[model samples]
Target chain A: EPEVTQTPSHQVTQMGQEVILRCVPISNHLYFYWYRQILGQKVEFLVSFYNNEISEKSEIFDDQFSVERPDGSNFTLKIRSTKLEDSAMYFCASSSILAGVGEQYFGPGTRLTVT
Target chain B: GESVGLHLPTLSVQEGDNSIINCAYSNSASDYFIWYKQESGKGPQFIIDIRSNMDKRQGQRVTVLLNKTVKHLSLQIAATQPGDSAVYFCAENDNQGGKLIFGQGTELSVKP
Candidate 1:
């Protein structure tokens, strides 16, 4: 089965540095999303991208965060400046409108560690 | 405050036994619900989902029950095996941009 895949399974960066987390969503999906989970907390929605624009975002998705679909298959999340609290597992997910929005397929996730 | 939460933090069961995981949602407007399984170091894998219009839905060896009146959902696994051990999370679809509001996960440990 086709699945969502992410690059740089683990990322380590300085607090003030910028970092980009990349994801290649399932081949034919139209909608993409990003979510994060603190070490012991529930996964929280960050942002959703469709048609090259942000469709919806959470309060947690503040000024520091941006998402891009630079190419047909590559969707990325960039943090302008990392904070210690930003360290968490970031996940990329994709879904087809035909499959119902609730049926999202998730990638393994990229573990971001900022020091 | 819209949130989905689990009843228990951890559950241990013997092999060949049945396991039922429960979830509670505070959002009455949430119409779609999904259950996901996450093994160690992996992402949440979609298991099954149900719509509020229906009371029950079933997949192979797995069944999901939704009670919109009580604002509750449950996932039942029959004849659980070692592979069934994982953290399970219940999510409610926000109906916009396909955003899912997830619940705190319940850890299932199958003792073989």
Candidate 2:
């Protein structure tokens, strides 16, 4: 089965530095999303991308966060300035359709550690 | 402001036994629900899903039951195995764009 893939399985960055997480969603997928989970907290939605634009975003996805589909296969999330609280497991998910019943497949996830 | 939550944070069962994980959702407008399994150091893997119009849906070794009236969802695993040990989460879709709201998740441990 085809699955979503992400690069840099783990990353360590200094506070105030910029970080970009990359993901290659399933080839045929049309919708992509980013979510994060604090060490012991529930997974939280960050942003959704479709048609090379942001479809939806949460409050946590503030000025520091931006998502771009630079190429046909690559989707990226960039944080302008990282903070200690930004350290978490960032996951990339994709779906072929936009229906509510459609199943979204998740990637292995990139663990971001800020110090 | 709606959320999905699991009743039990953890559940343990012997290998070959059946396991059931329960969840409660507060969003009455949610029309889609999914069950996902997550192993340590990995992202959630989709298991099964059910629509609000359907009461039950089954997969290879899993079954999902959705009670729209009470806003409850349950995942049943038959003949649980050691590989089934992981954190299971139930998510609900708002029927908008494919955005999903995930629950706190339940840690399932299968002992052989």
Candidate 3:
């Protein structure tokens, strides 16, 4: 089965440094999303992207965060300035219109460690 | 504010037993619900999903039950095995841009 895949399984960066997490969604997927989970907490929605634009974003997705679909398959999330509280597991997900709008397939996730 | 939450933080059962995990969502507008399993160090894997129009759905050895009146959801695993141990999470779609709101996970432990 085709699955979403992310690069740099583990990332370590210092505070105030910029970090970009990359994801290659399933080739045919039309909608993409990013979510994060702090240790021992529930996963929180960050943002959703479709048609090369942000469709929706949560309060946590503030000025520092941005998402781009630079290419057909590559979707990326960039943090302009990393904060210690940003340390968490960042997950990328995608869904095809045929798969139903709500059924999303998730990638293994990139563990972001902000020191 | 909208949120999904698991009723229990952890559950232990003997191998070959059945397991039922419960969740509650405050968002009445959520029309879609999904159950996911996360093994250690891995991402959440899709288990099964049910739409608001359907009260129950089954797949493989798992079944999902949704009660719209109570805004509750449950995932039941039949004849659980040791490999079924993981942190299970219930998520509801906010219906806005398909953003999913996930619940705190319930850790399932199967003892042989």
Best by lDDT: 2
Best of the two (1, 2) by TM-score: 2
Candidate 3 Cα outliers beyond 4 Å, as residue runs: A98-102
Decreasing lDDT order of the candidates: 2, 1, 3
Clashes (candidate 3): 0
For residue B107, model 1's alpha carbon misses the true position, in angstroms, by 0.3
lDDT tens per residue, model 1, A30-105 = 9999999999888899998888999889999999999999999999999999999999999999998722344999
Clashes of each: 0, 0, 0
lDDT of 1 by residue, B1-112 (tens): 9999999999999999999999999998888899999998889999999988899999999999999889999999999999999999999985644889999999999999
| lDDT tens digits, residue span B1-112, model 2 | 6999999999999999999999999999999999999999999999999999999999999999998989999999999999999999999988987788999999999999
Error of 3 at B34 (Å): 0.4
What lDDT does the true structure give each of the candidates?
0.93, 0.94, 0.92
Per-residue lDDT for B1-78 in model 3, tens only?
888999999999999999999999999988889999998887889999998999999999999999999999999999
TM-score of 3: 0.97
The most accurate candidate by DockQ is 2
